[model samples]
Target: MRSILAVFKREVALYFRSPIAYAIPFALTLFFGLLFNDTVTRNNQNAPADVIMTFIPGLFTFLLFLIAPLLTMRLLAEETREGTLEILMTLPMKEWHFIVGKFLAAWLYYTVLLALTLVYAGILWRIGVPDAGIAFGAYFGAWLYGGAVLAMTLIWSAVTEDQIVAAFLGAATILVLWLADIAAAWFANLSNTGEQNSVVAEVIRELGLRAHYTFTMAQGIIRAEDILYFIFMMIAGLFITTRIVEVRRWRS
Candidate 1:
């Protein structure tokens, strides 16, 4: 526990000390600010809920791909590249401890970034009534979504010593997940909606990152399946990361 905290503290410091760490959130703020302004400004007739509900979920999904790779690209890759991973492995600590600590640190940083987005919701509330449930749901969904993304990227980082390679792979993997719905769409278009096609389509849509949040969570409904998907993906990623790190230690 103490070692985990130590690593967590070190990682938090490393993130804040670096100027580049702030760049993605800064960009996110700018993009979301613009999006919110445009949404509210253009929305004269509808309730503020309409604008917010429409914007937040899609934006969160879009931002996930961009932010996850940037934050996690260097987590383990940098350590390996600089040969510090070997030094760290020699310490009297378990691999999961180090992995969990670093994952928590990155997760906390993403939470901070997501927190900044609440200002947009606050602004909407002041202007007009927004659905509190939907707003809060969107935020909760984003937090979990970010965790899943970070976990996957950390896996990529664990296997690769080059930060650029790790970042590219992470981003690519995220892009594929983000577009998973498209694959479903294509298959549906090619095949008639029969029992077989329906089953295939259902499976494909369920595998995509967008449908779970867009259909349910974004609409203010929290389904257990959606929540579990994120949790399962996150744990799966972390588990894979731990194994990879363990293998590397053995080889060293």
Candidate 2:
């Protein structure tokens, strides 16, 4: 446990010390800040909180679509390619310790990036009233969703030595899940307007990444099911990552 935490801290520190980490977060924050300030206006005097809450989660998820894969691409790929894995694997650390530590470290970095976006809330306060509850819940949901995305990216990083392949696979997987709802609809309804046939598609829609997030997060309603879904995904991906590392370690 202690070793895992140590590794986790080291991983985060390493990222912070590098230029890639600094540049990625800074670029994303500025880009998103400009976007939000433009799309979200204070004209109608509607609940600016709801608008911000919904916008931030989707925006962060979009950023993760780009950053998450790149972040985890080097997690295992670079370690093995640079020959650092040989020394690290020979340590007294267990496979679970290594995977969980690295995964947790990546997750912590993700949390920090999301936290830095809190400046948006201050902007909201300056422009209009902020919905504290909605903003908080939405960000919390976004964090969990991003954690799941990062976990899968980490799994892909372990499977291959090529960072490009890792990033493509990670992004592709998210894209597929993101489109699950629409694709499911097309499949469920042959004519695209049927009632009974669409039921099957509607059922599949619940599994879509956007659906769960929109229902729980967009409306400031945090459901246990959505939280559990993200947790389940994180555990499943990490477990598989540990299994893969264990196989490679013993085989070679």
Candidate 3:
């Protein structure tokens, strides 16, 4: 536990010190601020009940596709590239401890980014009565969504010593998953019957990152399955990362 905390604290400090950390929040603030302004302006006198939805579904998810890779690309990749991973492995700490600590640091950093967007929500509160349930669910789901993304990207980081390669792989994987639903739709359309029930299409849609969040959490309808999907992703991602690190340690 102490070893984990040591790594966590070190990584968190490193994150705050990094220019990318500040840059992400700055970008998010500008993007969300503009989005909220435009949404409220277009709506005029009556704020939409689903104002947050405007931010979550499309651009936000895309941002995650980009941001997840940027944040995690250097996590393990830098360590391996610099040959510090072997040094760290020689310590008394367990591989899972190191992985979890790094994961928690990155997760906390992403959480802070999400928290910064709450200012827009606070603005919605002053002007109108937004549905608290929906707001809560959307943000909660987004948090989970980001955790899953980070975990997945960290796997790429674990596998490669080149940060650029890790980042590219992470982004490509995320893009594919993010657009899985669209790919599925295109396949169905090609069938000429508009058959959404093709077994292949169904599986593709289910694998989409948006499928778990857009309809359910974005709409304030929280389902156990949706939550579990992200939880499973996080757990499985961490497990895979741990195994990779363990294998590397043995080889070193």
Choose the strongest candidate by lDDT.
Answer: 3
TM-scores vs. true structure, each candidate: 0.94, 0.91, 0.92
After superposing candidate 1, which stretches have Cα over 4 Å from the reference?
A: 192-194
For model 2, what is the error of residue 165's alpha carbon versus the real structure, in angstroms, after optimal superposition? 1.0
Could you give candidate 3's per-residue lDDT for residues 96-151 as a string of tens digits?
Answer: 99999999999999899888888877887787777888888888888998999899
Instruction: Give candidates' CA RMSD values in order.
Output: 1.7, 2.4, 2.2
lDDT of 1: 0.85
CA lDDT scores, all candidates in order: 0.85, 0.82, 0.86
Please give the range of 10 consecutive residues that has the lowest summed lDDT in model 3.
Answer: 52-61
Q: How well does candidate 2 match the true structure in TM-score terms? A: 0.91
Please tell me which model should have the higher TM-score, number 1 or number 3: 1
Clashes of each: 0, 0, 0
Give the winner by TM-score: 1
lDDT of 2 by residue, 1-252 (tens): 987998899898888999988898898888888777666764335544567656866778866778899889999998888888868999899988988899988998888898888787777777767677788778888999888889888888899989999999999888777787888768686865677667778777766777778666756788888888889889989999999988989888
**Tens-digit lDDT string for candidate 1 (1-252):** 999999999999999999877887798899889887877777756645655654765587677777788889889999999999989988999999999899999999989888888887777777778777877777788788888889988999999988888989999999888888998888787745777886797788888888877777777778999999999989999999999999999998
In the predicted model 2, the residue pairs found to clash are none
